[model samples]
Target: MTRKLTPKEAAQRYLREREPDVARATLYNHRSLLKQWWQWCESQDIEYVNDIDGFDLAYFRLDRQMEVGEVTLYNQMTVLRVFTRWLQSRGLVANGLADGMVVAQPDDASRNTKIDSITAQQILSYLEKYEYPSLRHVVFAFLWHTGMRLGALRAIDLKDFHPKEHYVELHHRPETGTPLKNKEYSEREVNLALWCCSILDDYIEGRRHDVTDNYDRTPLFTTEQGRVSHSNVRDHINQITRPCDYTRECPHDREITNCEATTRLHAARCPSSIAPHDLRRSSVTYLLDEGHRKELVADRVDLSVRTMEEHYDKRSEAEKRKLRRDEFGMDG
Candidate 1:
């Protein structure tokens, strides 16, 4: 008799089935949600993956809702519902089991999709003055100014820099390492502003540790052993943006002697600290606000016009109309 497949086994099969049609990033995200469910079931002593029902799924949904905000919960549930439907397709779960996992229908409300983008000027002014010559300062500057994805930044190499031209070449190298989100199509040379280039020059000459990752690729941003992982980059961005760093006052009012983020290596737990991707969104918006055409901004950011408007461009309707008026020669 064929052995019963575990949820872990099922998830892998589902991913393999979907990998051909979906983007690598999308596949990774789907696998992540399913992996969480598998781990949660294991924690609950669920020995048989095929045994979970809609009621169990509902409880899982509640647990997630309590742990995260509405936006996060909604995204997680949407992925969970997809996994449930996949299970149903395989005849491993009852029909319509995915319905129980649905918590709220996603709408066009701004809050439901993304948070407000923090402007480049706001973040850069703080990072430039307070955290200068630091990795956080460098990372923040690159993310905010380039409008590049975290993964693309993570993939940068030491040789990719052309200091004379104030630009760096981005390559998609999935076979060896450092895969760009859009693969080969994402490869291009991005020019930096004069000041930004100077900052990167100082960082390379002083701070960045010279090392090669396991793939034998020499990364521009390296820690002691090799290239810094994705989590490290995210942690650096999170810690530097803590309210205490910029304001000189701890918003949480915790004692300096007792706080977790007081040290250089630790990230702040401050609720307001935004992630690396938020910086990308902010870059797109800031450029648009400066009267840069939407198409130009989209091309510079390596995103399609529709994707930028639907996702990256965070301008309000009034703000958008104001931007268009300059081209139309209309009164403000």
Candidate 2:
């Protein structure tokens, strides 16, 4: 006889069992990805894991594709597949249920659109003037100035920060639930600009919530309950980047009354809204455009030089030519 387990219960047990085997960062990602699945199950009234079938999985895929990029959609399904297999092993789901779930092949297409330096500055200036010392303001400033990944940003703790020195250290602590993407290799001290540090100080002193995560560690960013969630971080970025939020006008000329993107949940649907990863890419390109050495940029961003040039560098050929001309004194 098969054991009965609610979808949520199975997910919790899976995560608990998998924690010791996987990197903390990976486990966090798995949890974040599976979260959508468990929510979907609740919406569909899937009382038990055994109630899930191939058709339910297919519909879940369709629902997710509407909300996330193809790459993200692919990752979500992959995690769901792994979880389903685990459930089957425990007799909570049917045999071959995991095999029946179809996973889409993710295309590694390059995203060319990014928030350029001018736009980034405009957004930051708006946040500074209007939302100063708030979580949204601090998050935008850190991502733009430091060019760190979302994982790295959330991994930051109060103890890792050194405002007096204008730098923060990144550490790998899997046991504590905050781990860098590349494990120990991703650890480094990132210097903050004086202005950035000033805002961070104000945020920590005045506006930040006094809370500790499950591990009893004080995160730099937090909600009233505890540390800020990954989805919340992404949502804050999405909401702030909407042109209407800062500029008070839509570039697409869509009426706010009829526009769905104006809503908080659908903010990313706006054409003018920028994703967090694109902001990081733009930061890398901006540094490179300013004639910073690629080696230094690579070290700061925790990426290889080759990867930075091939993937992160969004400079056009004409822009590259202009920079080269200026460097070689070809500009008359």
Candidate 3:
């Protein structure tokens, strides 16, 4: 007979067991996503994992669906499904409980939101002219050019970069606190363009903080304290991606000086500002639209081609048709 486990106990155990196997960010997200379910369990007075059934899972999904968007609900359900399956493996929950949970399907509009090439170029041009070699410039440029996930970008060390070879090797080093999303599978060499390499070199030589993290690893991106936190990287992206910040023209027709989003803390509130993931999606779509092969772009960005096509490819039908026509010389 299996021992009884409270919902909280099961969640803590699952997260603890998963910590070593996943990246710090991934583990943290899992914890956060599951925390809601655990809280719901407590509210419903469902004390033990054994008490969770198919109806309970359905009700929880309904409750959360009312509170979040389809994409967020999907993510929550996916994580909860995994948690349910894990509990079943431990004999804490009934078998097939996970099978009963339905993951939400996001609409095309939700999946298709991304920065376009023109806007991306504008941001890059502004950075190149004014903020070249600065932390904001380096981070934004690296994300746009490489399309690597923020976690992977943050995990770079001074030693991992090779200005001479024009590539950086990504390693899975969870013991040292920076693990890739796919762990060992995600480790690969990302090549840099000459322009990107030049900017990175300037930053390292002139502006980079040159500080070692707590693990004694010298991060390519850092502050006086150590390795930059994920939130800090996200904030930098938000701040720089604001249209007014680079363009000095507010498309929203608001007075720039009086706009709340002009402040560093509230930059994300800007209607035109985008998140780091938007940069990644934009980069992937830009590479594909530029005629790069799906497999090659997939390798560069560390994403499966299917995921790229389904989620990241925001190119319009007309644009895709034009590419095909140009490829076949049908334009003549």
Candidate 4:
């Protein structure tokens, strides 16, 4: 008979013995899921480690599928599979419960669906009509134009911007708390467009008033309280797009009308339907449309050619029509 270890004990041991190089955030997420698994086992009156088999794993995954999206359920299954293998290696469990786990794959039709890309004209319109403080406006403008991922944007410090060199060096300094998803060697320099530099110049000038001390280490983007986080940037974007109430005269001319007006006037006015990542996609699309080589664009944007083609190479209906017309000489 195989020795039995309690779920809690196994989890604690696994965590203590796991790879030290694993990110703290990733470990925390695993711990959270394991705790939930243990809690479910207790509630079900099941022997957590000893009784869990392929069937039990399948049922747990089915329960997760009912509550979560396909992608999340798949991720959960992956985590559980890794944990079960670890448990088996440690001799805490007789069976690897993940042997027969089934995870639903995302639909092919849904996988290729694309988000609306921000256009240069739309971005210009947004900037012209936005009424936010200068720094916020600058960040919005920069994101729309450069299509930098939020992670890279947040990692930028004042020294990262080199106006004289016409490029920004994205250094690998995880020790400074700016973690890159792709690790150190993946860090590369990005050439700043003239427009992007002009926006930065305006932002820096506006930011000087808010800085009492000459701290060059200060982040390129700051919050109202002079500190910023990834979530704070998301919140700012959300706050910028919220609808406002405006009163208008009733067409009947009998009474005044109060209507909630939601305008997509600028970056602040962009439809809340779009996300930050979509801006990067839009940039890639624009670059491709302008005849930039796929490999060159991918290198500049820090993406693989496969990723660029798979996600950002979407063409709009109008563009598609134009392409056909051009090829067939419809205008002749």
User: lDDT for every model?
Assistant: 0.76, 0.87, 0.86, 0.62
1-332 per-residue lDDT for model 2 (tens digits): 77788888888999999988997657888888777788899999999888888899999999987786555667789998999899888987679999998897754443224788888888899998999989999999999999999989989999888999999999988788777888999999999999999999999999999999999999998889898888888888888888889888887879977888788877766766667887899899999999989999999999999999999998999999999898899955
Candidate 4 on 1-332: residue-level lDDT in tens?
56777888777777877647686446755887788777777766776586777777777777766544444456677888888988777666655455666756655343222233443454444554663236556666666656677677767777788987878777655676666656675488888878778767766776533431123356767655543565555444433333221122222223222221132222222223234565567677877766667798888778889988888888777885786677668994
Better of 2 and 4 by TM-score: 2
Off by over 4 Å in 2: 1-23, 42-54, 65-113
Per-residue lDDT for 200-295 in model 1, tens only?
999999988888899998998788989877768777766666656666666666775677655654542444455677667877878888888888
Q: Model 3: clashing residue pairs?
A: none
Q: Which residue ranges in model 1 land beyond 4 Å of their true spot?
A: 1-3, 62-70, 105-119, 238-245, 248-273, 324-332
Better of 2 and 4 by lDDT: 2
RMSD of 1: 4.2
TM-score of 1: 0.81
The TM-score obtained by model 4 is 0.57
For candidate 2, report its TM-score: 0.81
TM-score of each: 0.81, 0.81, 0.73, 0.57
* TM-score of model 3 vs. true structure: 0.73
Stretch of 10 with least lDDT, candidate 4: 243-252
Count of clashing residue pairs in every prediction: 0, 0, 0, 1
Candidate 3: where are CA atoms >4 Å away? 1-14, 17-24, 30-112
Clashes of 3: 0
Reference-based lDDT, residue 24, model 1 = 70
Across residues 142-199, which tens digit of lDDT does each residue of candidate 3 receive?
Answer: 9999999999998999999999999999999988989898889999999999999999
- Say which prediction, candidate 3 or candidate 4, comes out ahead on TM-score: 3
